[model samples]
Target: MLVYVVDHNGQPLMPTTRGAFVRIALKEGRAKVTRTKPFTIQLLYETTSFTQPLSGGTDPGRTNIGEAVLDAGGEVLYNAHITTRNEEIPDLMAERKAHRQASRRGERKVRQRRAIKNGTITFPLEKERTPRGCEKPIVNKYIRNSEARFVNRKRPANWLTPTTNQLVETHLNAVKDICRLLPVSDWILEINRFAFMRMEDGSILGADFQNGRLKGYPSVNAYIFALQGGCCACCGKPLIEHYHHIVPRHLGGSDGPENIAGLCNECHGKVHTGKLSLDKLGKAKKYAALSVLNQAIPFIYDGLVELFGQEHVHICFGWQTSEQRKRLGLGKTHDADAVCIASLGNGSQPRQIPEPYEIKQFRRHNRAIINNQRERTYKLGKETVAKNRKPRFEQRGHSLESFLKSLSPVWRLDACQVMEVSKSTRYYNSEGRCMPGTVFYRCRRKTPGFIHGDIRRQGPSYGIMPFVCLHIILMQASRRGVMPT
Candidate 1:
């Protein structure tokens, strides 16, 4: 294992593989541990800034990032496969949106009740006026009818979706963090620009730009209907309207013309319910991964240039990386691709093939204070009757009574996920023996409660064990150097 080192002034120097030297320095109070998981130390005494020229190579990806630092002589210094949080962002954003909407509705309800009490409005649904030419009457004058502010909104030239932006940020932050650890003078990034149109049809000429896949067709459904000869694929029923997917959207299916099959309503329902099958419908075209990669590549390259300077940062295409990796007899992986990217200009093979660092990026801070554990008692066509329940006791063998009995006088139930607080990080060696430096407490909670880092000694006294707090050393250890405060 390589130990990254820094000077007395906290500036990063060359990393050392000498474990005994590092141990001696620590024992003699010459250096102190700065970070773990790519273990780093800062020296107490001043040191010279002389260092070897190191170049970094990164395989930019939507979900996983490959990072590697190499010396001038093709020596792999620092290598890591960083798992990004891009996939989780969308779901979290959707949940946040739902929460915000619910909060706004609750606030509006409270305001309406207050207005009714103060005689500002008679009742919650009391109508004040109706706009001309509008069929629906305007109810509740107290309810604010805000103007369309979205019309005046302006986006910058380089604007990306939240997920893509987060992904790009992850790449940038990963590079920045690595730079802080090692002296990276230049960077080589592996990127790909997909020609989606060419991939679909190689025969497509320049004139085909004017005429798209759905040029004459009004909609995709209409196009599919025409493609299927206006009849159901399973049953030859005329006047087919419903569009059936050969492969479901959830199962990596695209809504392209090839993936779509025209079917009657009954046939569509039958296909969905597995009562019937359409063998004529070929296959589903999946371009989601490719599309995401294509969209993110430019942004990632631009960010790299801005960080490492235009002269220092060099771009290598995906094909070059693949060719080199194949010639080097390396297996296809993110880390291997990164190594290939680094060894591009140099003819010699990488000498130092150390075990690469495996680093997974964590979600910075969870904004969710409460786990909305709602169980639906009854579900009709459009209505669902749900009862709010404690998140922890929902599982078998966990109960509120047991939790209450275990709780101390100082302890109170706060809204948070029980799993997070109870989670303990225990590192193990290659022989599967548990090592030291476990961060969170292994406090197994009987019932769900909030995760407050402030509960230091409260867990042990009550036999619950110390729970992992979010704002404590956990955040610093995990999410450091990613986002600025």
Candidate 2:
């Protein structure tokens, strides 16, 4: 553990070992405790006006990030791992997409039903182009009568998915905050590479290699047939064969022989189209490790340069750091990788390895519910806010009672089924859209009367279906909606 320090002016300074140094300062009224979470102190009296050239290193990751800040003397000042919250981003995005699609469809239906101007939607369905004398389906009545949008497949040149953009922002934010507090004039980030070229024929790949192996063809695709010992990589067939990229090209697999495999014509097409399995081709994922770290190059690199200035930012490869770690006999961990990375920035400085300070990024644990909500429309939007603010317990006693009491007594009807049809046709439009109908209910709960409109299936008409049957259904969809007269 270390004690964080600040100058008399409340400006951040280098941290000191939590021993006689900090104890003496506190005992002599030289410093006062400012924060207790990380045990930081603020100097009450004037202190040193100088700061050391601190170097920082980061092991950027998808789920968690490892960070370390070291002083010019190679002494560790701060180190900690951070857990990121991108897991729910995808689920939230899917929900948003569903909401947008529903809204668009509702708007489109309303416009068509009212014969209003066709706007808002990007691709309005158009009528079929007919010959001069040929007839086309009637618009609105028989079809949407809108035109199919032809040009809707373009995006801004420089664009990243919403999730990807957020991730990049999170990483950059962490680096910026560290630089502000520490006298960090230098930074190092360890990035991985997809170096299929370095692999040789019959050599196994790391588990992070998505498609496992390329059979026995090596990594070069230029002479795949020649490298396979004049035989098919699969089935040991001496007959003519076709080459295939173990992983599809669009999915990051390159044309190198290491990513190439030999198969018969039939097998080749199947593999390309995903009809044949790689296991059937005798390729195996007998490598150690579940995933390979993806190095975000130009994306993270350019941003770091822009933020820290190019002279301050330094980038290193995985192999270089691994070699360094091996020479130092360090364990394989994010912190160890970061140490090697910081060592590069430390240069020839020969000082004791600074004790790592495990710092984790945490603004708030988990997430606030508001992070998952968006602007809903009308009543739904209001209800959502209320639920988040103060959740109301739904009393089931009068929920369906309100809706049931609004139903008319079907004693006058001859058949129960006719009562069902009348209830529907009278209260709903031909398209089965609910229409307002009169509803008056007096329940013991006096739950404020509401004229709710909903499409009801016919068989459960009031005075037709048994009370118990109706009770069961209302329990399932107990929405306190009554029809407006």
Residue-pair clashes per prediction, in order, are 0, 24
Residue-by-residue lDDT tens digits, candidate 2, 392-472: 256323222233344476632232233221111112123432222212222222343222223244433333222234333
The weakest ten consecutive residues by lDDT in model 1 span 415-424
Which portions of model 1 show Cα errors greater than 4 Å? Answer: 105-144, 202-210, 216-285, 345-348, 368-485
What does the lDDT read for residue 74 in candidate 1? 81
- After TM-score superposition, the amount by which residue 68's alpha carbon in candidate 2 deviates from its true location, in angstroms, is 1.3
Number of clashing residue pairs, candidate 1: 0
On lDDT, the candidate that comes out on top is 1
lDDT of 1 by residue, 10-61 (tens): 7889989999999999999999999987789999997799998788899988
Candidates' TM-scores?
Answer: 0.64, 0.50
Worst 10 residues of 2 by lDDT: 419-428
